[model samples]
Target: MRLLLVEDDTRLAEFLAQGLAEAGFVVDTVAEAGDAEAALDTVPYDLLILDLGLPDGDGMDLLARLRARGEMLPILVLTARGALADRVSGLNRGADDYVLKPCATEELVARAKALLRRPGGALGAVLILGNLRFDTLAMECAMENRPLDLSRRELAVLETLLRRAGRVVPKRVLEEKVYGFDDSVASNSIEVHISRLRRKLEAEGATVRVHTLRGIGYMLSEEK
Candidate 1:
């Protein structure tokens, strides 16, 4: 999943970014509300981890503005204020959930994943395609009843394709999904991963296939 983390605390932001990255999320962080707004203008993040205390403006105002603009993206508020009033206000301002500062890493990750499981977010809790079953929480895939071994990039490629199964997913979208904005990608990097994923699934006897449309993109579809 791709996410924009808006936090002013450098240490906390770094910690959460690392943890989220390890948990298979592409995260771009901004310390100010202006930068956050600009980032949103470009990248379509799956969720937002926003801090109420910003260097420029109150995060609450930004949250309210986003909601007012009909942005229904899942937003998890990270704040030092643990008061009931703060929590209530955050939710009232369209925040999906709240985690107090100094909260457990596991709890934060769990909350984010829970929000992503909501409708219109990322993948569901579990994804089932043909005889292949994937557990989003576990980040594991199974073919029939056997485990399907795959590298991280391969899994990312497959995940992107599965989300748009039976439809074309452009190469740029796939690249952005699999790689962070700062990460340098080689020419045909996504194609290489897709090729590897295709071989692995075929060798595992998966009932689905990834097809490339000439001069366009790729699609995931059931095998004929």
Candidate 2:
């Protein structure tokens, strides 16, 4: 899933970004509330992790603005304020969950999964494309009952495609989702990943296809 992490602390941002990426999320991070607001205007992220302490403006303002605009995207508030009143305020302001600072990475990931598991987020952790099935939680994919072992990056790419099955995901979108802001991605990095994924799927005897639209992007669909 794609996530936007709005945090002002550089160290915490880096740590969370790395951990979340390993946990199979495409994470984009912005340190200031302005950038966070701007990012939300452009990208449609699956979830958001917002820190109340921002350099530019209050994170609460950003959350209020998003809620006022009728954006129902899931948001998790991460902050140093652990008081009960603070948690209640955050929830009342539209945050789906609140995580206090010094929180365990595993706890954060678990909360994120629970948020996505809600109705209308995405189907269960298992993604389906034709006869191919992939379990996101287990990081397993199978074709006609045969198991396919895939690298972490390959798994990340495949999950992105499967999540949006039949939709043309733009190359830039895929890059932002997978690499986030920490990695310097080559121009052909996405294509290379897709190529590798296609080979792995085909090798497993799956008839599903990953179609490239040349200048457009890519889509996954059943072979005709």
On lDDT, the leading prediction is 1
Error of 2 at 184 (Å): 1.9
Best-fitting candidate, measured by TM-score? 1
The TM-scores of all predictions, comma-separated, are 0.95, 0.89
Reference-based lDDT, each prediction? 0.88, 0.86
Question: Candidate 1: which stretches are off by over 4 Å?
Answer: none
**Per-residue lDDT tens digits of candidate 1, residues 84-189?**
9999999998999999988887888899999998878795877888888878777788998899898766777888888888999999889888887667899889
**Candidate 2, clashing residue pairs?**
none
Q: What shift in Å separates residue 216 of candidate 2 from its native position after superposition?
A: 2.8
Query: Which portions of model 2 miss their true places by more than 4 Å?
Result: none
Model 2 CA lDDT for position 42: 81
